[model samples]
Target chain A: MNTNNSGHSVDIVEVTKTFANVTAVHKVSLNIRKGEFMTLLGPSGCGKTTLLNMVAGFETQTSGAIRIDGKDISDVPPFMRETGMVFQSYALFPHMNVFDNIAFGLRMRKLPAKEIKAEVERALDMMKLSGMEGRRVRQLSGGQQQRIALARAIVIRPKVLLLDEPLSALDKNLRLQMQVELKELHQKTGLTTIFVTHDQGEALSLSDRVVVMSRGEVQQVSAPIELYTQPANGFVASFIGEINALPKARCQKSGQDFRFEVCPEISLNGRQPARLELKDGQMVHIFIRPEHIEIAGPRHNGANIVKGNVAAHIYQGTHTQTRVNVPGIGLVELRTKGAAAIDQAPLGSEIALSVPLDEAVILPA
Target chain B: MWRQTLFWVIVSCILFYMTIPAIVVVMTSFNPGEILSFPPNGFSLRWYEKALTYPDFRGAFRTGLIVALISSTLALVIGTSFAFLVVRYVFPGKNLLEGILSSPLIIPHFTTGFGFLLLGAHLNLNQTLTIIIMTHVVLVLPFVARAVYVSLLNIDPNFERSAANLGASPFMVLSRITVPLIIPGMAGGWLVASILSLTEFSASLYVTASRTQTLPVAMYNYIREYTDPTVAAVSALLIIATMLILMAANHFLGLRKILAIDSH
Candidate 1:
């Protein structure tokens, strides 16, 4: 975390937006550093796209301020903001040829004829669309048209680039490819980029920092690994990845050590527990990763283990997922390595699930 | 099955009844005999020649062409602006404005014609080409505006927003994107206005001066005074001109596309 301030790339200061009587965004303040790729990730109507639009100046925030490169641009219209946007639908001009569409901004600025020609050629080359200059936009394939739209936006050399779910319309394979290409493009251009998407995978894979949002509020903003490994709250934990939460039955404390009686499946081992303080008979929640549970292991004394019948085993190619039913404890999921056939876990067969006591994290219920 | 057959037969008969007069007009235009009859004595081109050579008919044709051209172009400009304003902006009384603009379509042409005649007479503008053109603009503006309004509604506002985000000014978006995309609608509106202006009778009869008589007014005058095949020849010529205009419109801008916009 290089926190030694590089001047803020794009600053949204207490920005609020409202539509009619409904509030779309409320007092959202964030600072994006220069050359940083930040994504606003949330579901539809969560105001992620609304915030992006305000940054692009296509929308006016009800209050607060927005600035790009330290200049207040809250009142500037979209054309004067000098920001480029890639729309979700790749709104290429249907009547214009590819080269002309890319050159539209330069033409609007009344650039010299020769300069416009050279710049359009350079943009086409940058987008790997050199030979597609003369073709009409509608004749191009989806991916090719998407590139043309990118070229059209970047040719102006804007201060910031805003992408609103730019890869959403593509098929899965092309979407993956585009994600890599867009990340590379961001690095190459070093432009302050604000991407808006509802896809957690896209936000995690491409952004330098991801801002998770829910119900029109920022939930968390961190690096992808940090967000996944140590979520700030239960909502973030569930939203970022899968986690199995178990209810705590009791807790005991000695000096500075605290121990909790979690799921009926787990029991404490002999260890020095002489620190921390917690009351007994207190209910709590324990968070554990599915892969931490060990199946078909040799029995160890005093280990956190539970005996249960294998209710269901699903074959998922790289790993086998099993649902085990323990009496009075309900069902728990365990994902083990290798194929289901190789694991040889039959339905209704008795099995023992074991996990290290230290691996489970107890949180306030 | 029998009822279906009967319904289709009745529809076909009605269609034939509507087309019979047009058929008779064409037939009389080609009649070799001088008299205008239901069935032609023989087929010839002499009536066509007579209609073309007649000085009054030529004058009236020229007047109608000029009036139609001026009225249609002016109406298209004013009507499309109104349509865009109504569709895109939020202003007080927008609905009222739209209703007032489209009122001409609902009002009978004769009522509009007589109202305009009385207004023009009081304003010392009666029996003049300017008044005729003004009245045509009023009569045809509603059709043009309604056609263009439908087209504007179909276009996604995001397209304009994308253009704005790409550094295009409002004027630039209108010229480079909006106008070109809505051209099919504009053409349809222009064609309808042109046809209406060309064949305008009730309004033109009230406003047209003796020297500025249009084709329909001239045809009315000629029919009342004479019973000759030349009148049918003139009517046939007018119908042919209309057909040619429609074919040209279709060839350049597909009629299906224009009709689709208008219907919406």
Candidate 2:
């Protein structure tokens, strides 16, 4: 922890992983900067875990190369890769106590007993597991076990830290708490980290940049805000957060501005990046976040407005999800802060909603 | 109530049926009379003294000890390694290899002894101690393999992966993790093979020269020639030896855990 190290950079160059007849990871390439917390986010079977394993040297890539800090380590074994891993199951050695578990890597390096003790104690204090080192792993609770797993990995001060859904097993409250601690740990150590998880919230909240994957291929890679505001494709737009997909919307170019005929009665203004290639009458999918649409009132006239009857108002703790059934547009869900939607627009009542042009994206269908 | 009573009665009857001869042998060993009998006329240690002093008794006892110790040690090493290989790897003919290893448990000892006798003769090593050791090793292999295999099945593959991830070499992982975890099962198998080899009569009879008779074969020959209490005295001593071995095994690795009753 005291070393004058800026952490290692990992470069995955067109790595592919296949198992027997099934290809788990398509040709994928990524460069993780030094001291960056990059997360691989995807659904199950999307090759996120496979990609992480290849970097950790647990799973060999079928083709292509992986380099750490400008050195090729594709042929290195897991133990010699110098990557610390926190497994999904925690995978704590049941036979060893917390102290021994954390001391294992140092011992493998053949460190002196005095140094191993000091390092293990430092890790215990860092993880807030100071006095619990003497206790067996099975006696600790799930959160404590996870803490020990983290402590064990980081005590060695590895070149890169690999976490495979490490906090997925904890309860909801503990998961949020651990998420904050994990972020704090990353900040304190500044270790180059690669986290693999399927939960979008964990990915968005914890990562410096999230790589969204689907069907064994990368869908998009961007910072959390950019990824949410501007998704590269339909899948990324819908997967990151709750989004209303208006499919088969035909785009019409009116001079410079793009208008999309989302429905028979609704012609919505489409907002996209300046360099995007758009053509008239092109079939495209329009994505709008639930919170992006606001309830229209008098003197608040907007560019694109649609009328719909409130189908259902589901009150969440922080906001109410209002499902509106629009004519020729099917059902569109909108998120209104607090209890405003339920009180303002009751069930089966006509409500006018405005969709801002900049808040939505029109992608090729 | 009737079913419970019937079950208890059936269990008691089976126990008595199995233990009656053993009880008779123990009782007759202490009898003052020259002939073996269940009810003793007077309690005496004369038969024990005579049995200990009998010709060739000490030599046969030594032979039994040597063969049991060597065969069980060989079986424990080879069988446990074989069990680990079968449990951990997927290779062609795995099922066939397992079948062949475990077939000895179901095959009759005398038939196995006869098979080994012919093989030993063909190799021109019929009466050597190496043949006895080799035959006994195969005879006890099935028990050791099955016991260790059961224990190996309880281990998770993640443990090995975790060990390797922690920087342990393959040999270190096996010695420090896998072997220590399966010690109870190994001890159980070792004890069983040792006991079986000690009492093995038919196999020893087929392979052993007259000068190298095991205790059981010696007892068999003595019983055929004599009608005294000396055989009973030897049997009683062997029963005590078995009990001592069991107690020692229980002390080292609790017998219940080794037997898989409480392995978890």
Candidate 3:
């Protein structure tokens, strides 16, 4: 029914899912643009998978509707929904060869054998699995199975592509490689892909737009960069990446700038062009990323300097994470580049930390 | 060294305890003497010929085969569907249904047979082939259901979901995915049910009349009346047949998988 080379758009409106007494997904609605690669990212039990299942029609919503290309299909059964999904287990028929597995959807549609074979071959070729057509599903390695699963889902070329943690099964290196292949496949097919995963890294790297969900509700739906930089709440801030939260920091409005006082001795200055949503002396929480904070010069005295002792230094290859315990603030983590910080900032050494509000978010306490 | 020797001696004694009766029956069946005796005057196939050629034995054997075939097949279909239901959906009284079906295992075959006999008599279908087949189906349904349940449990639920998501109806998912994947379990269950139904003596005795008696019931009758090695011959044949079928099942279907002994 779809003649466009680009994908059919999906509109999920006020979708809520409940299992018995437990609500897995609350009244959450999202609009996915045609050919856009969207990911539902959350921790386990955050209802990301439930929302994806609703879109694929595996799990129907308690209320509300899902539309494909402006047509509502909430009451449609999964088989009639015509949305292709790649499960977490791959779910390739263990009894069939790779070719048959990929051709299964086409065969289900009663497509001509010649056309089905051509499409399967084309999919296999795109996934770089040309010679694996005759191989059994169990024979393929984890990465190859992943590729075949992708090939199978995309070969159908349905209204939307659903992936349920497809890369979680692979080892780290293979997962990274498959992530690239997945991105390229999306570009080639232009199918409106709805990817569901709990890993923040995969969500950040793969999705055009990432939906950060928590506690059965959509915390924020934005591009990956915006999700990281401008998280709507405390949950989104901590979930997307590591950040330090200064709880109950009383804010004061002073002309064009804002100074947040943590204690009599320690204060943070907000010069980041102001969200300007806070009132004078409003109790708020400040969020600053690990990468933005730097070890301030000891002689530096002013609004943004805070005294702390180096608590720990975790040496990662790219960047060493330095933890500082400010008296008013709890353990504040900083991602200082290279191993220089490890030698420079030893344990229990008093350090003056510079807190940058350039990317910090302040929310009402 | 003494501990190892003691363990081996104990194992050998247990093995002898288990298999000596079968060895004696197999040996006794070949006795050249008309009367049943072990270490016979000379080995002869006379009893085997008699066991094969006797009219009543022949008729009983036919009945047993028919009953076993029909009952096992019926059990296979019912049990596989029931297994699918148990694995897929949860409803009220599910455990109760499972308990009632599997009660035949611990209910004593004679009691089940007696119950069936009473039902058949009340329906005025006493000792008929249909009644006997129905009895065997109820008796063997539990084993078939358990085997298929183990198999269905082993299968990834995603396979069916994946099929349904791929534009296949529930029936298509059953036909294309569920049935094919659990076929080994079905075949294994069917074979076991057939064997159990064939050798079933107490139930067969209660359920069948003289005209529709099964092999084991006929063997029981011959044992009481005639002092001959024919029953031994029949038993030897059955033992060998069952052993071969089980071994073949183990080789082909991985009996350990169906029995869930090793689980892998």
Against the unseen true structure, what C-alpha lDDT does each candidate score?
0.81, 0.87, 0.88
Residue A72, candidate 3: C-alpha displacement in angstroms: 0.6
- The ten-residue window of minimal lDDT in model 1 chain B covers B255-264
The digit string of per-residue lDDT tens for model 1 on A1-365 reads 11223223899999999999888998898999898899998878889999999998878999989988778999899988878899998888766788888988888878998998988888788778998988977678889989988888888777788899999999999999999999877767777789999888998999989998877788888999877766666667667756776655466556545556654545443222223234655565556677877774656554567778888887788888788887646677788887752356678888877755455544555
Write the candidate numbers in order of decreasing DockQ. Answer: 3, 1, 2
> How many clashes show up in model 3?
0
Full ranking by lDDT: 3, 2, 1
Candidate 2, residue B123: the lDDT equals: 96
Give the C-alpha miss distance for residue A127 in model 3, angstroms.
0.4
Instruction: Write candidate 3's Cα lDDT for B19-92 as tens digits.
Output: 99999999999998889887767888999999989998999999999999999999999998888788888999
lDDT of 2 by residue, A153-210 (tens): 8888888989999989999999999999999999999999999999999999999999
Listed models, DockQ each:
0.44, 0.31, 0.57
Compared with the real two-chain complex, what DockQ does model 3 have?
0.57
Query: Candidates sorted by TM-score, descending order?
Result: 3, 1, 2
lDDT of 2 by residue, B183-222 (tens): 7778889998999999998878898887878899899988
Structure candidate 3, residue pairs in collision = none
Give TM per candidate.
0.88, 0.87, 0.94
